[model samples]
Every structure is written in structure tokens, then in C-alpha cells.
Target chain A: MTVTVRPVTAADEAQWRARWEKYNIFYKRTVPENVTANTWKRFLDDKVPSYAAVAVDDSKPDGDNIIGFVTFLPHMFTGSIEDQVYLGDLYVDDEARNGGAGRKLIEYVYDWARQHDIYSVYWHTQHFNHRAQLLYTKVADKTDFVQYGKMIKK
Target chain B: MTVTVRPVTAADEAQWRARWEKYNIFYKRTVPENVTANTWKRFLDDKVPSYAAVAVDDSKPDGDNIIGFVTFLPHMFTGSIEDQVYLGDLYVDDEARNGGAGRKLIEYVYDWARQHDIYSVYWHTQHFNHRAQLLYTKVADKTDFVQYGKMIKK
Candidate 1:
């Protein structure tokens, strides 16, 4: 099946959320409803830097076109004049894995970042996600950087 | 030495830049002059989300009070309603290492983020940065996440 990528639109909400929720479930996260609502709105708002794109199969019907989604945002980087983008969320439908959807989605962001003069597109992933890393290592370079964070207890 | 953290002002430019350059040097990076200029301007502009705070020694003379600096900015997070901050650049002067300046600088950002309702403050460090990790382990939790990036060639 041939897959194509494009910016997410308002009409894509239901399917997007369906997949977004499943994506969160895979990571064992329970995101509040408001954050999901805000994320959808920001993707459609030009003023907000956050954005999302979807990978769709050309052979699929309109309502069922989307098989994967990616969320990204450009932010200031001290090491470069041009902003760098963070590939925040990326997931493909379970049945659609290994069909090039994930890689296509990432290439879509790389193209978008380059068009905006962003010189770097970076992301972090769990060490145990060896499946995703297989595709990632082919499309990007894995850096020797580790993450540390202070999580505030509510 | 009693280290205190405060929002950086215009008067702190020289010292901030000196330490910023040194920070970059330690990572073996040569940031362009324009990026450095823009970074300084963003820190002072309330309109921009980017911010910097300096760690100072109360007993030192005015010009020399600055010991280290941390740059951070809040951005929307997909998993939460509240924004999260990225502690971008952090450095303490060579002679000032082990004086608690690094920890104090991080604590300052935590306070600022908490006051603004940001629930997470995260940063990345090179795998070889065991010195900073020593302090990091005390103040934050290290994650099993590794970084991946695709750098665009100009």
C-alpha cells in the first residue's frame, strides 16, 4: 500500500484522537481530556508552534485514510540561529507497522523542518522500544545523550 | 560561599556570555555570533518565553558575583495541561564547580516553573558528563530515554 503524509486538519479529529489515545495507552499514560483538547486545537492554530501530521494509505477510504500520526514543534536552540524541532509523538496503527508509515511520517517532519530553516529535528525514546529504534537508527543518528527530569508531584 | 539565584539583568551580560561561551566550549561547539546575540536579547525580553538566571556569590564584589547561569523555557506538553520547561543551557564557572552553584541554579528554575504551574523541568546531558550527573542524581530522576536526531547540513 502506498502511504502519503500531510498536515492534520479539523476533519481528522476523531481518528486522530482514537490513535492518540491508543498511543498514550501504549506508553501507560492517562492524559487528561483538556490536554488532548488543547493539543488538537493547537494543531489547527497558526499562532501556536505545535503541529501534527498524519500518514495515510492512498488505497484506503477517506474516513479511514490515517494510519499514523506525528506531533512536532520548533523551539529556540542556543547552539544554532535557526530553531530546532522536537518530534514529540509518533505512532502508527498496530496492524500497519513495518509498512513504511513510521518512516514516512518522520521524513515528513524532516521536510517541514528544513523548509522552515530548522537545522535539527530531535526526539527521545525509551530504551526498550527496540522496534521503533530499528526504524529510527535507519533514518537518524542516535546520540549519546540521556534525559533527566524533576517531576512535580501534584 | 553563599550562592543565590536571581533573574539575569542587562548588567550581567559580560559575565553571562563568558560562562555561556565556556559552556559551549566544554561541549566542543562553536555557536555563531548571531545566535549568541539573539539568545541574550531573548532572555531579557519579557515577550519571549526564553529566560536565564544567574547564580551569584553574595560575598563577592559586584562584577564578580556571578558564578553560573541556567537558561530555560516553558513549552506545551502533549501529556499534560500545564506547560513543561526545558532546562537548556547550564554551566558554572570552572573555579566555582562543587560549590553548589549548579544545584542552586536548577532549584531556581524549579521554583519559577512551580510558580508558573509547570509540572515538569527536564534536560539532557552527554553520556560522559558524569560530573554534572553527580549533582543531577541528587536533584532529579534520570530516565531510561536516549536521544536521536537528524541534523540538516546547510
Candidate 2:
């Protein structure tokens, strides 16, 4: 099975959505269709300053069907001299697991970051997501950062 | 030598800026005047969803005001069902040290968080800021969370 990883385009929306649905199921969460549609629209909307990349299988000849996807946004810290890329989502189909598709998507992001002179890329995941952690450990340093939150009264 | 902490109001802008200037000076950085103004405006802007609290010394009946401040924004995490508050900044006058004004401001925020039924309150500080860390330790769990960043090319 030959897999190709490339930047996401409007043409790959349907295939990408199918894979995203499977990915969402693994987490046992259901994203509303409108939200998903809006996210997809953001991926293709250059004015939004967000980017997404996907892995596809070319052997099927169905215009390179997407099997995985990653999305990120650009931000600058208040006092930091450099800007950063924050990874929002990364998902690969189970069938394509360990086939280097996920790694390729990450590598592509790294390359994009390097080419654009981005200082670093960061994301968060649950402690139990071992597979994602395995891949992440290779590309970035895991920090001691934990998220904290409080609710506000209306 | 008495110090007080209170909720910020539009009338406190001038003194707030003075304290903010001192706050930034401690970090060896000068936040642009425009950024400070915008931040103050955001805190008081009803259309915007941000909150702020201030520390003041009432000893000087005239023009005796804000010595420190903290600001935060309300947000909901994707995986968490409850709303959370993200603390944006915390500052106290160096001269007001040992008066417990800093602690008072933090306690106010904690009470505010509780009133809103928020599960937790969180903020990030530089690794070397021991003074801030000391105060934080009294209120929240000091998790091993570390921040990492890569710069993006302009």
C-alpha cells in the first residue's frame, strides 16, 4: 500500500471527513457536523492563517484519498522573541497505523516550520495516548506543563 | 504602610498603568504603551469578555491607588465540559512587598473563581520567578508543566 502525505485542499474534504469521523469515534466524542464543516472550511481558507496537512493513498487512483490529517495555528508569546505553531489536531486511520504516514505528516509540519523559520511546534494529549506519545517524543521535548482552569459566573 | 487590593475600575487606569510599568520593569522589558492601553481597555470594555482585579493602598486619599493587578479570560476546554478561567497576568508593586497585597489579589481571584463554580484556576509563570511561584504554591498544585516554543520566520 503506497501512501502519500500532502497539504490539504478543498478537493479532499469528503475523504478527510470520513477519516475524521473514525478518529472522533476512537475518542468517543461526536463533533457536530456544522463545526466539522467550519473546521474544514478554515483549512482551505488562507485568510484565516491556519493550515492542515493530510496523508493519502494514491494507489486507489481516487485522486489520493486522505487517511490522516493535522492542523495548526500560528501565535506569538507575550514576552518571547519568537513565534510558535500550535498543533490543534493530528489523526491517522487505524489501517494506516505504523505505515509512516503519521510520521510523514509530522515531518512535513516540521519542514514547513523550519522553512518558515518557526521556532517550535507544540501540542497536548492525554497521558494514555501512548501511540501519539511515541511519535511525539521523537520530535519534541515533553514539558512538565499541566493545564488548570476555573469557571466564570455569567 | 498599609496596602489594599480591590477590583479594578475605569477610574484606576492611571495608577494601574504606573504599577504595570513597574511590573514590566521587574522583568527587564518594556511593554509598549499601546499594548498596555489596549489591555486596560479590554478589562473595562463591557463588550469584551475579560476580567481584572487590582491592589491598591488607600493611605493617600487623593491619587493613592492601584499598586498591582491581575487579568484573566474565560474559556472552555475542548475535552472538559466545565468553563475555565485562564489567568493572563499578575503583578504587585515591589515597594508593597510583605504587605500581603499580592496574596490578597490572588485570594480575590480564587473567591471569584469559586463563586462562578469553576473547578480550578490556572496560570503560567516563568521558571525562575520564585517569588510568584511561592505565592502560587499556596493556592494551586504546582504541576511539572513546562512551556516549549519554536520561533516562526517572519
Candidate 2 on B87-123: residue-level lDDT in tens? 7678887777767887788778878777776645767
Each candidate's DockQ score against the native complex? 0.78, 0.23
Over all chains combined, what TM-score does candidate 2 have?
0.61
Q: Lowest-lDDT window of 10 residues in candidate 2 chain A?
A: A145-154
Q: Write the per-residue lDDT of candidate 1 for residues A79-101, one digit (tens) a residue.
A: 77788899999999999999999
Off by over 4 Å in 2: A1-3, A150-154, B1-154
Task: Indicate which candidate wins on TM-score.
Answer: 1
Report every candidate's CA lDDT: 0.92, 0.69
How far off is residue A77 in model 1, in Å? 1.4
Compute the DockQ of candidate 2.
Answer: 0.23
